[model samples]
Target: MIKRAIALAAVLAALLTAFAVPAQAASGRYFYGVHAGLAGVRDYHGYVPSTYRPGTPMPLLVALHGCTENSFGFDLLTGFSALAEERGFIVVFPDQSTLANPAQCWNWPLPTNQHRGLGEPSLIAGITQKVRSQYTVDSARIYATGISAGAVMSGILGVTYPDVFAAVAMGAGCEYQCDILAQRDPDEQGRAGWREMGSRARSVPVLVFQGSADPVVPPATAGRVIEQWAQTDDLALDGADDGDIDAVAESVVRGSVPGGRTYTHSVYSGPGQGSVLELYMIDGAGHSYPGGCSCSLYGDPSGPDASGITWDFFLAHPRR
Candidate 1:
């Protein structure tokens, strides 16, 4: 009778443990209405590591989605939330107002949107402030990353809110807006725009990733952006060199910046960062996250893993 009682107690304990473990692992999702323009836009987000508790400060990463894309799509495609789990960071995805643009693209270039006090930049800043108030977030460690249109917006955010974001990573996007201007020649206006954009965030470090074969945004544009940032930092140019060209068939060019870091221009090697700018050029790859699902119009699985590489870069540099 004594043995049976002991066995029954053990069984009950095992059952309780099984139930409690899953309950502890469950994650919660939250939604809030953010005021953008005259109407309030609903922003949906999921905070991961489900184990996060109050008073625990964690690094925050704001992941923006591309045109015609939503938060759920970006979360599924990049799987960055998984990185948050391992790194113990809070990841937020802010949805673009589709009412403004049917495709839900970020307004990165419009003069009205580019200003510090209004438009998309303000909306994103508001989101960050809201999250900071609700959670214990490290202000100095705040970062932003995105895809395509969202990537362009990330650059915009870095420039407009340099005091807010510590670092930024852009995939398949350029430093300046690619739109054509009416008063200026296409080529001349493009160059001037890049220089102006570079001037805004002269001190902020940036990581840029582009596909060599990307049809949407040319690979050369990525190189130009890196050069602009390097020049802004007054870094010595190291010229071009081959990077991961054999196995992955990538090439790179490196330059030294004022700090102990070097600016790198890669054309196929795994993702890496230099001083103020780092470019990852995927050889034979198109405008998609490498090693991820080939769901987009331009996606290649044979290139370097961008999600992992970008996260690593962000971890190395915190806001100084």
Candidate 2:
């Protein structure tokens, strides 16, 4: 009887091991928890590279997920956690609850969610702050990136919390106040974004990625995001609406993945320093995360490596 009982215990342990969650890898620490802040309660997942030390400050990145997505799935879709381990940065993925939006989308279009210290933006920022409290984060090197609705919220973060995020990256997303700007042009949208920034306004560097063949988010919307950010930076530079920050591409480099979609890389110079905006237009690609894991529905492995490009951009543009 004793032998039989021990054998059953061993079988149970094997079953538990088989069903256990997989770790990020042997090289990094991956964790998840809930953060209750002034805005509300938010669930989040995080990854810290093995290279991180107790006293050393590491760059922090907040990655938001799109509709029908959650923090864990986004982490797998973009492969940002692996990238973080390789690059020695900390990454946080904030989950959107179904209760907030039935589709599990970030409320980027609503007025309440578009401003500073309000709604989803505040909740996301609160999550970021919470991560900071628990980790050694470099204040000036903090960055934000997202896809679809998540991408729109990333832009709103740049507008509403300019002091917190040093740079922004959008994937298959439109400009700030995109829903309301349907009748307006990119220039008008830029003005609205600048106004949204208010006194905390600064020229936040932005990187954009889009699929020319994307049926969900048309290429034009991505183009609007590029132009709108340029206009906002123009205004932020000298408090004037003048187009000092040229939206025109300083250089256009065309490339193609081995057997995948061809792409155009455009660089737009900023008002004061280096390129403020970089646009990657992937031809023939659909609405998906470029160069993401094939395991996810939104992942497009054959496209350009957006995650790598985003990290490089963030590293290049620390807050002054």
Candidate 3:
């Protein structure tokens, strides 16, 4: 009977681990009334570092929540608000609307929603703009990030509105175009469209965390995302992988977590040694943020520290 009870307890724990829940925001306030054109309105919440003062322009991080996730839950998972408080920056989380998607997802896989200045992308950018307008925000240092669906949307924002976002980070996500046909590889025309859009938008730096054995998003998609972002940010319109458009260099480093999984960190550089793309491919990580708060719903503490590493990347690459 003791073994039966223990087995049942283990089963319950496994169920909880699989079904993720969003954490409540720690900065404590959930604000509303901010509206984006056509996309309607959603709740906004965040935390300001203790050192911040009124009228001082602070850097803003606009984080988007994944399906069935809330701003507060997102805050608890990534611990970005806590990091913001500690590092003297600002972090804002925007909730997804059920009207757009029943799951409250960002609608990243839809073809119609993939374009710039339209669909959910516009709404997200509007939230960032609204936050900037209300607060003393540093226009040049704004950034975006998310988990899963939200992460894919972050990639869309980076391509769609590069002028607004200085840098982007995504976990267990795909590129801007994740339609069914684009799953294996994006067609030539679609790839060209992304390249053109990114070029016109003044492409920003991107950081991606992809689980090698991701069950939802095929891990191959992450490599494709890197290829698209690297070529697009570099403005390489050439069709071949080994093309002489400009200079593309990559450096690789390997590391492991103590009593946990090992991972590979790859940084892709463009002209002037600027980091255009960074990829962390964790060997055993699933569909969650690496080194994130395990106590939170959607996190795996066995990988690299995402909040810390991504923030460092954000600081290094401001809008050019």
* Model 1: per-residue Cα lDDT over 190-292, one tens digit each: 2343344443433456788877777788877775555434432232112112221112224557543233223345532223333455676666566786555
lDDT of 2 by residue, 102-144 (tens): 8999988788987898898999999899889999899999999
TM-score of each: 0.71, 0.91, 0.83
lDDT for model 3 comes to 0.74
- What number of backbone clashes does candidate 1 have, counting pairs of residues 3 or more apart or in separate chains? 5
Full-model lDDT, candidate 1: 0.64
Off by over 4 Å in 1: 1-42, 177-202, 231-274, 294-299
| Residue 144 displacement (Å), model 2 | 0.5
The TM-score leader among the candidates is: 2
lDDT value, residue 269 of candidate 2: 91
Please, what is the whole-model Cα lDDT of each candidate in the order they appear?
0.64, 0.87, 0.74
Highest lDDT, which number? 2
Clashing pairs in 3: 22-73, 23-72, 23-73, 24-72, 25-72
TM-score of 2: 0.91
Off by over 4 Å in 2: 1-24
lDDT of 2 at 140: 98
